[model samples]
Target chain A: MIVAERKPFDEIKNMVSGYKKVLTVGCGTCVAVCLAGGSKEVETLNAELNLAFGKDKIEFGAETVERQCDMEFLAELDAKADEYDALISMACGAGIQFLAERFPNKPVFPAVNTSFIGVNLDVGWYEEKCRACGTCVLGLTGGICPVTLCAKSLFNGPCGGTNQKSCEIDKDQPCAWYKIHERLAGQDRLGQIIEISPPNDWSNQKPRKVIQPGYEERVKALGR
Target chain B: MKSGSNLEKILKAGHFAFTGEVGPPRGANVEALREKVSYLKGNVDMANITDNQTAMVRMSSWAASIICMQEGVEPNFQMVCRDRNRLAMQADILGAYAHGIRNMLCLSGDHQQFGDHPQSKGVFDLDSMQLIGMVKKMRDEGKFLGGADIDGPPELFIGAAANPFAEPFEWRVHRLAKKVAAGADFVQTQCVFNMERIRAWVAQANDMGLTDKVAILPGITPMKSVGMAKYMKNKVPGMDVPDEIIKRLQGVDKKNVADEGIKIACEQIEEFKEMKGVAGVHLMAIEWEHKVPEIAERAGVLPRPEV
Candidate 1:
């Protein structure tokens, strides 16, 4: 899931300082699940901004939708959001960009910083899980993503800095390769990791587009 | 004549080799570098010039290595994957070779987080294993990683760092073999203090017949004092310092603790000499270069073997 962190109160407050009526928008998906841009968080930020602005200096409204990245959910606030002087999005980067796109006349501001694609290790804690590098070698590495876990993202094996099952970076951080080797050794699949890996393919054609296969077929059939 | 380096010739002759290291000064203090280089000139077979050791910036290893050459000491230029990308590394390899450097040690550098500038970005476009393979490609096949044929390829002896004492003790040997597979012609293990653990690590490495495949030189960093010993035992990652040695250093007079540390380092080298598959010792007197000559003499590896 995409993880995000809320921008500083001062920064958010300063962004909507000139706007008389500002709506703090929230997304119900990744940012909401991460507790940064949920409806309740939006309410808290709305009240904080109102109080910080003091007595009628600015009017603030809080609203949340299923997901801002999706156009359908964004349609709910498409017309309603434009009435405000500005819109502040408390979603990931994509959501904030989409919100700005949906309400072109109103200024759109981000209230949260999108962190990473990660998993919740526990409540209130998240760790990065993938790099979306377009190449996946998880099967070859015994279920571990050396690309994400290893500090250097080394695929061959652990560097000499792997210490006592921990990384040279820090003792608390377990070396990713150690875990890979352990998992592979247990499965008698160590040979998989022993093989050399060529350099990763990072074909950097930016802002890449991928149309889902079935959806592409449907669109082709419609010929719209 | 892979590299035609003095270190390579000694190892090729089946003679026990001795190598020492020198960390370049933080700035352009050539006098400081030369002083350390002079201390190690005739002491060891070749001096390993470190690149940003401990993640701190220093004189460039290739530049310092060229200086070592001017000072009459052959340099085993160490390149870490932390600081540069493939283009810069390959470019530097050609440049270093042009300056008469024949030896190169590949390492996945210490993380930038542990450096003077923690906020600085790290450019690990290639890890150490890949770096080794890439260098070998340049040397053996006369081809760049981008698969372009080179005008004049660098003839080099590839070196890599091995940490037998790190973790998953059973797998460390296999890890060394993996390095060997990556085209490492030789290697220097992480610093050793616990002889028994490294012995076990080497035993496993020998069982896999890795000793014959590559020259294995275990690193030896002598403790400077009781505090240094304790700090290494507790703070330094991938370093194994036994408590007994710490106790031994502590048992000495405060001034002579360094001597005791040197004695202990000598003792470790003594053990390494008797161990099978161990081809050499990389004495990392870190900042204590002056002590290397004395330590080498006392360790019974003196009258440095002439290849």
Candidate 2:
């Protein structure tokens, strides 16, 4: 899921300080689960902002939709969003950009910073899982992604930096190659580790439009 | 006579080649660098100029290699994949070659977090293997990584590093073989205090015929003191300082600890000389460069074979 954290109050305050009437729009999806832009979080932020501004400094209202990135949910905001001088989006970066595009005339500001595509480790805890490097080598590396975990993104073998299964960068960070070696060894698949991996093609990093396999023709037909 | 380096000549002559390491000073103190280089001059066939070792900022290897050359000492210039992209890597090779550097060692440098600048960005566009392959491509095929032509290719005697004592012990020999296959002409193993493990690793490499494919130089570091031994054992990444060696260091008197360390290093060198598939010894007397000559002499590798 897309993990995000709320921006510091000072920065958020500064962003909406100029507006007399502001609506805090929160997403009900990824950011909500991460506790950044859910309805409860939006209400808490609004209450805090109300306390800081007293009643006269700024007028604050809060609303949350099923998903802010989707146009259908954004259409709901479009109906009542016209009265506000500005908007504070408590969603992932994609949601903030879509909200801005939907209400282009109004000033749309982000209330949270979208971090990475990650898995929720525990309540309010997250760890990055993938870098979207386009080409995946997980199958070749015993399910560990060296592209994301290895500090140098080394492909051939572990560098001389693997010490006691820890990375040279931080003792807490496990060495990706060491883990790969262990996993491959456990599966009796260590022979493949010696095979040389050619340099990755970074051309896959260019902004891509990936259409779901079977829906490509239908999408193309519906497109301009 | 690839690159025609003196080290290459000595190894090719079937003599046990000797090499020392010189870490460039943090600042551009050319005089200090010259003094350090002088310590290894004429004592070893070649001296390796380290590239930002420990990820600490220092004078670059190529620049120090020039200084070593000017001081009548041959340099085995080191390059790490941590700092440069492929473009910069190829450019540095051409530039360093123009400066008369003949020997080059490819490495995946120590992470930046281990250095003074912990927050620095890591630009490992290529690992050491890829770097070795790229160097070979430029040298043999006379082409750039982009498959474009090079006006003049750098004829370098390529070297790579290995840590036989590192984790997943069974993979160590195969790792070295992969490096040899990557176009490395020679290899220097990580500092070896675990003699038994290094011995086994080398034997495995011999079985795989890596000795015929590439020159293997077992690395030796003469610890300065018991504290240094403990640091290398406990703190340094990829190091395997056996407890018995540490016990030996602890057995010595405080004043005699350094001598004991030198003794241990010299013994390792003698053993490596007798071991099959062992092409040479790379002595890294860190910050104790002046003692390399003594170590080389006591180890009976001196007079440098006149190659």
**Best DockQ goes to which candidate?**
2
Cα displacement (angstroms), candidate 2, residue B158, comes to 1.0
Error of 1 at B1 (Å): 1.5
DockQ of each: 0.68, 0.77
Query: Considering summed lDDT, which 10 consecutive residues are worst modelled in model 1 chain B?
Result: B165-174
Report the lDDT of model 1 for residue A156. 84
- Give the alpha carbon lDDT tens digit for every residue of B203-280 in model 2: 999899889989999999998898999998888888898899989999989999999999999888889889999999
Q: Return the lDDT, model 1, position B136.
A: 94
Best by lDDT: 2
What are the root-mean-square deviations of the candidates from the true structure over C-alphas?
A: 2.1, 2.1
Distance from true position, residue B276, model 2, in Å? Answer: 0.8
Which residue runs does candidate 1 get wrong by more than 4 Å?
Answer: A203-205, A214-224, B305-307
The 0-to-1 C-alpha lDDT of every candidate, in the order given, reads 0.89, 0.90
B231-266: candidate 1 lDDT, tens digit per residue? 887888877887888888888899998888888888
Q: After superposition, how far is residue B92 of candidate 1 from its true place, in Å?
A: 1.4
- A1-224, model 2: which lDDT tens digit per residue? 89999999999999989789999999999999999899999999999999998879899989999999899999998778998999999999999999999999999999999998889999999988777888889999999989789988898878997887898777899999999999998999987888888767765447777688899789989883
